[model samples]
Target: MKSERLELSTNDVKLADQILESMPGFSEKMLQITQRLLNRERQHGRYIVRDQLARGGMGVIYTVYDQDLRRTTAMKVLPPQILHQEPKVSSFIEESRITAQLEHPNIVPIHEIGVIEGSSLPYYTMKLIDGEPLTNVIRMVAREDPDYVRHYTRHRLLDIFLKVCNAVAYAHSHGVIHRDIKPENIMVGKFGEVLLMDWGLAKYVDADDNTAFEEAQDSSQIIEHNPSRTEDGVIKGSLAYIAPEQVLGEPSAIDKKTDIFLLGGTLYQIFTHLPPYEGENMIDVLQRAERCQYEVPSKRNPRAQIPKAVERIILHAMAPTKDKRYASCQDLIDDVEAFLAGRRSGGIRQFRVGQEIIKAGDKSKETFVIISGKAKIHRSVNGRNMTIAEIGAGEIVGEMAGIGQGARTATVTATEDTETLIITYELMLDELRKLPPWMEKIVFSLADRVRINSGYLHPLLLENRIFPLVNQLFLIYAGAHVQAEPDTPISYPLKDVVNEVTMNLGLDMASTTKVIDILAEEGLCVNVAEQLSIPSLQDFALFNDYCRCKMDINTGVKKIKEIQLTKEKDSCFRQIVRHLHEIDV
Candidate 1:
């Protein structure tokens, strides 16, 4: 079945024209929403221009309706000035032709390319996407949550950029290079769909073609000798997103990683809400781009506190030397996925004795967990060295800042040859969420301990929270002296147990035995002579009551500690304990 499209009134066209006119640098263009509608109708047989979407450097975009097709479409019409420019005209045509061949869900589809009558330039129509450019979203975020820009931006940017990479990777596989990729050329839809736009500078990867080879050779020379060619021509990509090699005109040597660099730059801007490099003019920006070294995103945005994995991804992607960048977009994507999944994205380098693993007040990278060997935490007090704590194998150091303000509270130095597993705050949170409920309780308990004690305990103690809880819970129900054979059925011992309890409730050997005796006396557990077992619950009321008591006590203790440490009221604490007693009794 065909869908129907609506026709627009003259007033609607006038309103659209006014809207386009109000935008930056589009006022003088010959923009008529009505004219655009008429052109769409003439070209496609029947369509209507609903409104102007946006104006770009070379053209104006309008949202239109195709009456016959019953679908919304975008009309990209070149302004007269850009149409007359021979290079731009050729570029527009090439972009349309190239984009039409790209068929990916993440790449907007180009429908048709033609010259509107009475206008000497070419115009193209594409699927009108109902979304905002990625740049706009970043801007909105900057306005709303400027404080946590680093954390939020990195997540959002990585997500969108990964989709961008998937699209560009598909294009590359099809032998196309989108020489221009910037935030302005990316759109994120309401339903989380991402589309890569503007293939204007797209070039085919055919070495056998004489003209292409010659063009490639020329571009290579320009890239090698001139680092300022980025300012020349139409400047296809945003000045900030131009790769260093691209800024130097090295299009011939530009391979997949070149796009990776642009992807990194675009992500950097999105993540930080600021470009990697900024300048007052095109030349200045081009020079900074050519230098190819900028402050890491974490350094630039104090609130950003980028995870080490993300920092590594960005820096590697933006490596000035092509060899230093990721070998392929897929490699970059894999690391990003690893980071998002809360795992080690890659290996960590070993640090020498006395080496500064992390510096105080430096927020560049995330903390590292000692996989092997030992390290010492240091903080200077009154110009003297103070040993805050020593971290042995399996201990996580320098996470205090990462979880909170992201400022290093102290410096960590390796005391011996060490192999540390580095994790970012972003990755940690993701990983923590995936843990089972029992595991989560242990982890949160450890985190709470760290927060309270400030890393004073042995690393082994930190790692034993969950195991200890499980062991203690079983021991409590089975009786402290009860022993089971290796092949003994777990249900036989626990079946008659009464106290619905867990290790989280500060259960110890003695207290656990007392609870078990209470359960036995209460008939919650079945004692067949010397053997102990939990009773089968036809109605889970008793089991539910016991479990609720254990959970309530554990939660209450945690809250009380928090209140005491924070110097807050104990009213909430007293009220909880009072409620627990009433429920349990």
Candidate 2:
């Protein structure tokens, strides 16, 4: 005996739906029955549904067998109840079309797209990937499973991130933006194949396609239910990882940077074992997303030992504003690859004593970090060079000029043999661009202040004005030391010298120390082990006379004195006075 398949006509199905709607449970049961009858009737174009593989907000993925092609495949289809809804139908069809257009290896290939026979429901068959979603792998790693912990090292996770970047980059090249990028949508195959799944929220920027799903306003719709996946006609993306613009519901803000933000969020989860945003519920998470409020990856999970370079990349990509984010996936890829390769954009420079590291009025956009030794910052005022500040190892210089993007405001010279890291403007801009808009504005303002303050009275003049007290203190101590030899340095306890200067001149220890440091820099005094040593009392006396001469010239006090000295002493004194006279004090 031959079996007969029962089929319902279009009107009969509609009448049954209306009748079932009158009863509560009957509607779902009847719809399932009708779906089964339709499947048995036409068998969905020779593809038999085997078992449900996966399900997402948009559709259900089933393990289907192709009778004609004689192979197993994955078929994504919408629930039969939502078939008549136009927005859902349009979104589903667009997703199929977009996925079919992107033919990258990391992106699942669409094998066939067709409507089910005897109905308007649509489905698409894709290559069946033998893999689990990245969400599963992340969970396993988070639990610290012995196998996962040993296998999924930081390097391995980064490799997965790079593969995803390649796919996103390829898609972006074709003018497609994956607005729903996250770990849940990333499928990691058992054999190291990483595929970016679900192009359902992808936007076709090259075309004016308005069929894209709208953003959700209600947080309740997205909570506690696949919070990692985006839904159609509700939330455009997962609340935990969506960009601020996505949470703001501005479709115009969606661009390449938006996808970069999502990629950053995914990378954050890889190391920190938590999404960038977290709260008690979806509303709290959405608020955090809107405000871009989240602890940095380093503070979020210190044990992860997140590399500083990788953390910078994440912060750059997930910048609060889209303008601050990487402009393209390729730009992000370059940074990630650079970090992985242990490369830096900064160059190393070695400067000998008295070599100029930076010259004022020069148009250069490089900032220097002192790696060893010390340098002096000086600026020219009225054709006279004045020392502005002293910078030693582990200090940064020229950043103000770099941030201001203008001519160098001051000159920097190595006082001793020095090494520095020269950071180019391009690299500085790359990192500075990641700052929040307000913070960036503040940084620019500070740079401007530094540049403008060069015209004011310098602090070196104040140090010079207090130079007389140090001279008097030295003279007092030198006279009292009757045991001092002719060429030997006269030593005095540093505290005693500071106290003597402060007691007589009403000066603080810091002021006295500044004067002492100036004398030390000029080689007149040597400081060691809480003791001040004058290398030569003759040289010290000569420098004191030079200070008096400079001060008298500024104060309009005409005083002349005749002095005689040896050739070596005269030469040394003249050289020191010449440098000091450049300050015009």
Name the best candidate (by TM-score). Answer: 1
lDDT of 1 at 110: 88
The 10-residue segment with the lowest total lDDT in model 1: 560-569
Candidates in order have lDDT scores of: 0.64, 0.78
Write out the backbone clash pairs for model 2: 216-234
Predicted structure 1, TM vs. truth: 0.55
Q: In model 2, how large is the Cα lDDT of residue 561?
A: 55
Number of the top candidate by lDDT? Answer: 2
Off by over 4 Å in 1: 1-45, 145-156, 207-236, 345-450, 453-507, 510-585
For model 1, residues 442-483, the per-residue Cα lDDT tens digits are 876775656556634333232222223333444454553257
Encode model 2's per-residue lDDT on 321-370: one tens digit a residue.
Answer: 87888988889989888766545657899999999999988998888999
